[model samples]
Target: MLEIITNNRKKATLKYVRAFLFFSLILLILFMLFITGVVIYAKSKGAPPLAVPQSTLIYASDDSLIGETHYGEKRYWVPLDEISPAVVEATLSIEDRGFYSHHGFDYKRIVGAILADIKARAKVQGASTITQQYARNLFLTHDKTWHRKITEALYTVRLELNYTKEEILEGYLNTIYYGHGAYGIEAAANYYFGKHAKDLTISEAALLAGIPKGPTHYSPKVNEDGAKNRQQLILSAMVENDYLTKPELETISSQELNYTFGSTKERPVIAPYFQDEVKRLLASKLKLDQETINTSGLRVFTTLDPELQSIAEEQITQTIAKDSEIQVGFIAMDQHTGQVKAMVGGRDYTESPFNRVTQAERQPGSTFKPFLYYAALEKGFTPSTLMRSEVTAFTFDDGRERYVPHNFNNYYANDKITLAQAIALSDNVYAVKTHIFLGQDVLVNTAKKLGITSQLASVPSLALGTSTVKVQDMATAYSTIANGGVKQEPLLIEKVLNHKGEVIYESTPVKKQVLKPEEAFVTTHLLTGIFDEKLNNYTRVTGRTVMDQLTRHYAGKTGTTRTDSWMIGYSPQLVSAVWTGYDRDKTIDLTAEKTYAKEIWASFMEKAHEDLPVLPFRAPEGVVAVQVDPDSGLLATKKCSEKARLTYYVKGTEPTESCIGKAEITNEEAPKEADEEEKKGWFKRIWDWF
Candidate 1:
């Protein structure tokens, strides 16, 4: 009986063991299937692009914020190489000690957290590893719910499967949210220390590492003691992880740190007009896509000089009346490189989004005469070339139509005058005679060669700037003349960098020889005649209003029309263009409106050159500067001391007149107007331009 009972008990025990082992196998299979399904679902979802999109950032030449394109906000992404190694050690020690060993989820940590939760009878401890926390920060909200936890588990698995450990860490470091609208490690570093992440010391890195746990409560800006305590905790953890010694932690904790206190504040849009131009050029010049310009996180290092921009704006504000409806378009450029340093599109950007500099096309008025004069110079016309300045009508198209041009205020010399005298007086009749003599198409072609892109009609009025041109194009055209006949396309952006800090584009200075160097210098010299009162004939030279205030020599022209007033000028180092007029072609009847351009140009040039060394317009090779009588264009002598002026000419095109007194502006001795060909004869006379 005892043996039978022993056998039955043995059988019972064996049966119970078999049942337990079978149940364990079934449970393992179910668990495996559940994990497989979770992975399949995660794969179906894939990863919604890991990077948060940001718009391109624009910076001035000095690396300050000029403006941004679209919706980028303040977050900055830096590679792991740029991040401080101490930040990594501190974060790993405190946030996830088993980060490297864990695949995605930490089961051991989960079990421990569960035991702790049961002990407190409340859900308190978290089992998130670095990977899990990254997944949650990127994709989900931090709420205590089983549904959220399951979703987080799927994301963490996806991150681990898709990216490597280093990549995951980089993404986490870049995308994690810190306090006070600081989003990434780079931005946080800039905000707190006014420095880059790569420059952070171990102590600074520890302080930053502590912020993510409780951003508001432990932010040094908000709670100094809390931030200090949290930093100490992270440093102690670093010691435990063998990343640092206890003594090192104590020393770091005691070290004093300086905070920047001022950084990443709300930036006002600077050079709004220039920013618009950068966008347009980025598309047209570089072939950058509109979408990329808006969201590629490009770091556009532009050529904007903030000090000059401020001066330009101030000049406009001070010159134009506060209540005036006149609009202004201005641009300042480096003559040598064509880098646009400053620009103001309108008086108020908010009131008018239209960019007058690049968008508006208006008549150039007398400013157009420079091209005509330059063309004449190339055709063997000298500064002493004689032109009869008087009211004259010319017949063209078989004498079917007559076009007569008039000077400002209908003033004229009504006698034989030199080219320099005609330019100084802005004599319209002489300009028309020269325009007619040059076959009407010469001035148009010359303007195009100088970089004017706007359409120009090859008509007699084209010599007078009747056809419209953009201000930027006008500046570029003059830059060619200012740089001694070399064309330089405008440069708004010096270099462009993509989100990964890879150079995408760089400026190469579009330079090409266009005008004859000697002839160009003569033309540039003629521009100064507008400011020289000694060249004054029937009327004051156009720029004489600001002549006394000008401390240095400048090559410039002033254009006046029924609607538009223009001032475009250049020094050896800088070129500036200013346009002021009504937006809708209303006649600019106000004297203030007409003088606004000149005043602004004068003020801007003087203040902009405050710290710059005085640079003279050096004469190029094959060019000769001669002191001549302003009215006769003859070589200067002691007898013509007060009236003599320095003039530039092509080596062979200079005047051969002896040191003799020329005819003065007197109604008594003035000669009658000469015929068309005779009016433009090459001889001794004066030249002046408005």
Candidate 2:
């Protein structure tokens, strides 16, 4: 029994030893697995993260044409592929030598950096590897703290697991801010080089690469010596990393830095007046918000000809003159295409915010007479139709007042002036008489069809520009006549392209037939004669004195409203409308020997006509120019001094009879009869009898 019990004890001891060994191996394996899992999880969490839809940078075409933008700051981001290899290598060497090899944190480098810091006992230590720094810049704020560092480490691990190395570097390069309001490598390159990131030079690359450490402290523009020293450090790293040979480094170190920084924000300063119009048109057409319209970085291709724009600016500046306090607005367009080539809203863009060209409504004065005359022409009144340019009156139903029409000189010759002669002289009485004969409704309708959308009073005085209209609308009106009766709404932006190079909007020319080509041509011919005619047989009139020295014959009309002066003229190549007035409409001191209105017009025309070929107005298919008596507006005889006239070419359109034979008062008899009648009036007889 004793021997069997001893055998059982021995067996039990052997089994106990075997169980202890197996349990020991199991615990050791579990311990290794836990450490491995922790390391893998930490590294997975360390990867640098990225947010969607990064803020993009926008640029203007040149330094001279910029639209106002309200961005956080202008930044032009360059893609990773476009950046120079040297730029990337140099930045990596200076910032993080172990960037490629490290998962997110480089413990070896961090320890060495800390040791070096302890030895130096100075706060100039940066142990952050390129990957770690990228992680910090991307996910963490700039405030330094142990707690933040711990969080940065966790994020670094996340970044390595989530994103690729190349992506982290890209985000690092793009997201980091360099001082001087720049936020990316691309912006820094442009900010310094006045060129795109793809256009950066080697020296420029190094200069920017050195900015991330201390953007403000070592900015090349602010501290050249500090930048140079920082740059030398980076160059040494590049040499050590085999990015550059020693010889290349030596050569680069000796070269002078020819960096230009303020050149960075080069944006085009385009026509502000046209830009404003574009915004308005886009708002109405595209139904866009102001924020989107202003900052879309949209590539707008306009119909503006650069040459014409320069000419227009020069013309306006010359016309308004540096000394004049008057503001002037002008716009010129192609008669056929309706392309607005040149426009100026005010004398100086910087001085004024008021856009007078498309705004400000003032009575267009005698310039309004053309619409009434055109109505009469369409109503079977030939250019030679007889009209009385004598003092005229009308009694209104309100019993308020009767407006007697008088010429600009406050004198009226009671002669039977032909329709053409009356228009040429811009006689108010003749315009009123013709307007009444045709009816005021006819004139208003004709004017509206000719692109005059301004409100018109339902009275005969409407013929005298009693209705106020803007310069742009007036330009549209005249352009219709110049365009041979097709009304085209003026356009500014031709197309808009988005950041990804997608076209968003393009303009299609919108045209509407507003008048018969024949009517339009007849009006053009009559207005042309007003400029071409020599004052003969009509009373020695005081209106615009005809200057015969001009070699070219073009159609134009001048106007003087209560306080505004205007000139709307057209040649074969361009149509120009000009307005000059004070902001608050004060009657311009016409006492000045030469009123500013005419001088402004003359100056603008002289400059505008310089490059434009002297092309004559093309009369439409059925129109013809013929010579007639300026006084009688009839077929000329040998006795007529002003025998030159332009008559319509249509068959049956010519005046068959001479006004010399038909008129009740010849030029000589009318003035005498008017004086005799005036002598018999109550006030006149009292003065004469006394």
Candidate 3:
């Protein structure tokens, strides 16, 4: 009976052994087939299906960092040589102890992880080695499902078969994600330690290595205690792997490392609106693919002046009442090169991301008259040409309709006014008559020739700038005038380079001599008359309100509508345009809101030109400045009024005669002895400018 029982036990043990051997052989065959299929697919497809995404960095013209643009993952790629050895060792120890030894997976480790998952009744434990984890990150998602698991396994086998172990490791280090918009070890090191990846110490390396397990939990900025706990585990793993000694581990454990994020230090974008415009230009004007801009790791060198950009932002915030709902758009450009130097969309980017300078289109008001007057110059009208600025209704469209233009407060000169006086006063009636006499097509064609792309109706009101236009386009047209009538497109980026520092796109200015240099000089001189009180007639000059705030010479124009107030001006070096009003075009009634544009423009232009030389506007050849009487429009002589003004004109266009000598001089019309000295002082200032 005892022999029979023992024989029964032996048969039972043999049956269990047979079943285990059969299953093991089937599993081994299946694994071999999977590896073969993965190798075939990897070879046929060339590289892995995943491409390492890259980040783009933007720099100011001074070669200082401004900001960066990226997709969801912001990665700054670095080679294996750029990474610290401590970081590599620490990462290997904590992430995959047998990374160098295993092909891509560790079978024994997989078994242990499976057992642990089964014990916990959850899919928490993962047996992904460094290569496996990297393969999963590059090729698959983190979802805990059978489909993703199989895909990850396939990619792991493919990576081990096709790439060298070093290559796989380098890619893994570059593709790993850290918290706070940083991906890859280099960006993480710079973000957390304020240093480069190659400069990280052992403690920082260990701390960074532990972040991959759970970025939310192990990030030092979020949870320092949890990060420290995981850092200790990383250190212990390094010790066990022979990367560090027990004594060194203890020393590192007690050491406190400084985290850049833990302090008050912050690195916000220096120029948000400027960088945004750069992005738009890259995609829209340069015809670069948006995807390529966000991922090709472009290095964009722009024309932004950081100091001027700061001043512009400060002016907008400080000049406007903070609690008011008014919005503002401003732009400053290098008139010579057509390079945009500074820009601000609205008061704050956080509150409104809409790019007003580039996107918003509102009525430009009388600011559009420069193009009209420029067109008049292109035609035969000189600065001294006379027109009447009186109230009149014009019949257009074959005299079927009437368009009556009104001046501010219904005030009119009710007499003859020169084209120069008209521009200085922004007289609507004079502008309309000039617009009509020159034929409406001439102004429209002239504006289009300069830079204005917005549609013009060719109606009578077109002279008064009734058409809605972009502030940037208006700036571009004025830049052409400021550049002595040389037309060129506005540019934001100077050059763009690929990740390899190879130039991809470069700007070559295509300037066209659209207007005569002499005519442009005369027009610019006419604009300067706006600030001179000598040109005052029925009303003060449009720029008179803010002229006292200026310390240097400037040629500018002010435009006002029921909803928009504009100030556009330029010196010899820079050109700026400013607009202030409600966003929804509501009527602006406050006296303060009405004057915000000119005040901001005056203060900003002064601060902007403080460091620049006090250079006068250059007068081109054939353009001569002649002293004349404002009332008579003739050469200034003792027979003229007490005030004598210098006005610019083309060589042949100057008045050929002097004012008729007054038979009798009265005290009211004649200057007192002291007033004569004071008048000389004012004329001397103008003489010194020449």
Candidate 1 Cα lDDT to native:
0.85
Runs off by more than 4 Å, candidate 2? 1-68, 77-176, 185-187, 237-243, 263-270, 282-284, 294-296, 305-307, 319-324, 396-401, 535-553, 591-594, 637-642, 649-651, 657-690
Model 1 Cα lDDT, one tens digit per residue, 1-690 = 999999999999999999999998899899999889877876887764675645578999999877766553457778999899988898888888888888987889999999999999998898888888888888788887999998888889888877888988888888777777677788788878888888989899988999998888988999988988888888999999999998887889899988874455445679998998899889987898898888667889999999999999988988898989999999999988889999999999999989999999999998888989999998878898777787887788888988888888888887778889878778888888888877888888999998898999877778788999999999998999998899988889999998878898988876799999888888999998888888898888999888887998798999999999999998887999999999999999988788999999999999998888888888899998788877767788776767888888889877776564444435543454333435663542323221
Backbone clashes for every candidate come to: 14, 21, 0
Candidate 1 residue 470 C-alpha distance from true site, Å = 1.1
Cα-based lDDT at residue 377, candidate 2: 71
lDDT of 3 by residue, 1-690 (tens): 999999999999999888888888888899999768777886776657446678888989899878877766667777789899999999989888787789999998899999999999998787879988898778777888999988787788778878888888988888898898778898899789988889999999999999988899999999999999999999999999999999999999999989886132257667687788899889977688888888877889999999999898888888999899999999999889998889998888888989888888899999999889988887778777777778888999998999999999999988777778889998998888888888999889988888887888888899998899998998998888988989888888889988656898998989898888888888898899889888889998999889889988899999999999999999998999999998998988999999999999898899998899998998988988888877567788877767678888878888877865556556676656457657677655442221
What TM-score does candidate 3 get on C-alpha atoms? 0.79
RMSD in angstroms, candidate 3?
8.2
Instruction: Kindly list the per-residue Cα lDDT of model 2 for residues 1-690, writing each as its tens digit.
Output: 999999999899988888888887888888889657756877654533354223322222222334545365554435678777878888888888888887877788778878888899975567787667766776778788999988787777677777778878877776677778676687677677776666766666777899888888889888989998988999889999988899999898887866667563554455777767767777888887776665554556677666666766765665455776778778878777788877778877788857888877888887787788777877877777766666768655475867777787675657677666676677888887777768779988988887777888868788888888888888888888877889898867677666434788888998998877777777776666545536444444222453432445467777776687777777766677878888887777644412455555555555667766787666667665566666666776545534555466444777665535333458888898788977686975532221
Which residue pairs in candidate 3 have backbone atoms (N, alpha carbon, C) closer than 3 angstroms, thus clashing?
A: none
User: Candidate 1, 211: how far from true, in Å?
Assistant: 5.0
Number of the top candidate by TM-score?
Answer: 1
